[model samples]
Target: MNVAINRKLILNILLFVVMIGVIIFVIRDSLSEIFTELGKTSWPVLLGVTMFGVISQVIEGYTIKNIANEFNREFSIRDGFFASAYATFYRVVTFGTGSIVSEVIYYHKKKLRYSEGTGTSALRMITYKIALMIWALFFLVVKNDAIQRYITNGTFLVIAGIFVTLLIVSVLLILSLNINAQVLLIIFCNRWFKHQKLRDIVDRINNQVYSLRAAIKAFIHDRNAVIRVFCSNMAKLVVWYFLPFFILVQEHPTIDIWLTVALISFTVILGGVLPAPGGIGGFEFVYVLLFRNVVGKVDAVSSLLLYRYATYLLPFLIGMIYVLFNKQRQINHEFKKAKKRS
Candidate 1:
């Protein structure tokens, strides 16, 4: 057990180092100008942006807590926050694959079953997609003319994003609701793959699919919890989408707030299409490409840098800190328990 734990720790540390290197490489070109913009920005504005980012995470934690309670799991708000933070940390370092692993481990340690953990994480993702789709559609309609005027191939991108989002949601629903689909999927895999090992993998995934379907049914039946989680997700998006506006508004006080928010929503929708971790490179590309038409090149880059700092970097750092602190606390707890036994 200790050997396995140590190996996992080593792997996570390696991933963290690689993630930092990639981030630096991605932003190296803009570092100088980003620093200049940071210098000009007031401390108060930076603090406000940071606060909003913190609030967004707290809301995410609340959503997790509510969802767990709906499932009869004994999860506290603090546990939710820590779990969400570590999930974010792993999500970044592992190119979006490690979030679920981290959450399942965290939830298991918190006394919840692994299936419960997986189900909760899956539901959180589904809620986020639903919220993003709703907000994206609303803003697309409200600022349709402005977005089309500024963004190249804006209509196509919006349509593509909507289609992609809808496709994902629809597929998840089908898999969860249709046992026939699950059976057919397993049968197809079995028929084509001669490897017993591959067949075992499919069987494991099929079992998890059963758990997820139960979770989806529970989530749907609890209408009030659904509303609460959905609203919290929307609140999180609002804070995230408005962050760039806050970063730029000090200098460009004449910037239209709604237009900025709408562009951000569009950027987020399109960014999801990219497989990059946390949508790092693709998100920056889309943000700069679209915002430059409205805010000019330099401001676009500067605001994006600051916005990334506030939303991405800040939360990630906080999560890392919490992870370290939690580890230390666990060590102390074990030491005390051992001492008492001795």
Candidate 2:
């Protein structure tokens, strides 16, 4: 167990390094242009971006709170916000499915049962992704020309096919709950793990998965709870774009507000869909590419920088601070608990 934990730690560290390298490489040229443009940005515009960011965070907090409520577990708004902040920080560095490790840690610290916490987190994440995709699809309808040009036909076709496949799989799995997960796991393990020992371990996982199915079914059965969570998550997705629209308005008051909102909405969804951590390179690249055609080069660059600063870098820095603060508090709490037990 200790060896496995150590291996995971090492693997995570390697992934973090790779992700950071990718971020630096992608942002290097863009950062220079963005910084140059930043000098010309008005103080009021920057202030507006900051204020809008804070407001967006409030929406994010409510979404997490609603997700927690879906589990019939009440968590403080501040806790949810900070936990999410911490989760974002970890995910950016890790850049894999294991980006979920932070959520597990946060739930463990909150003293929630592991199954409940993980199930709730998984549900919330799925709902959040769906909300984000819905926002993206809506913007795509409005910004069809821009999307058509930016999203290559081949790429769009591939994404569409993958999305449909995932939808069908999810529906089938949900319908055939228990056996499906096991069969899926077995097939997944057989393809992925070459080692016989690992294959057997995965078979053991299939057996243990029955307990997880029950937990998931219990949570899924709550239709009202799901709707409440979905609505809250959707609201957060809206705010993601709204905040950027506010930033653009502050800078260039003459711009079409609805179009700006639509553009930002599409970019936010793109960021969420992109695999890059914090959507570092992915967001800026897609935003600049699309925005350049819609809004002029100068405005696009400035607007992209301002938007990125408000939405990505600013949150990243804040999450770093929160992670540090949270880790310190956690260490202190653990020490106290240890002392009490002693």
Highest TM-score against the true fold, candidate: 1
**Clash statistics: count for each candidate:** 0, 0
How high is the CA lDDT of each candidate model?
0.79, 0.62
lDDT tens digits by residue: candidate 2, 1-342:
555555555555565456557556534643456556557778887777777666666666666666565454667677677667667666654554445667766866776566656655666566666776676566667766656665565237324633754584475346337576667767777988999899887764553344345545775687776677678777766666776566656646777666767666666555435545554576676677667776667677777777767655566556667765654565556555555555
lDDT of 1 by residue, 1-342 (tens): 555555555565565566567546534543455556667778998788779878888888899988887655578878787778888776766667777888888888887778877888888888898888998899988988876897666878886898899898887778888999988888899899889999888887887778788878888898988889999999999999889888888889999999999999988888866445553587887888789998899889888878877676666667777776665565556555555555
Where model 1 places Cα greater than 4 Å from the true spot, the runs are 1-41, 193-204, 274-280, 333-342
Model 1 clash pairs? none
lDDT score, candidate 2, position 68 = 61
User: Total clashes, candidate 1?
Assistant: 0
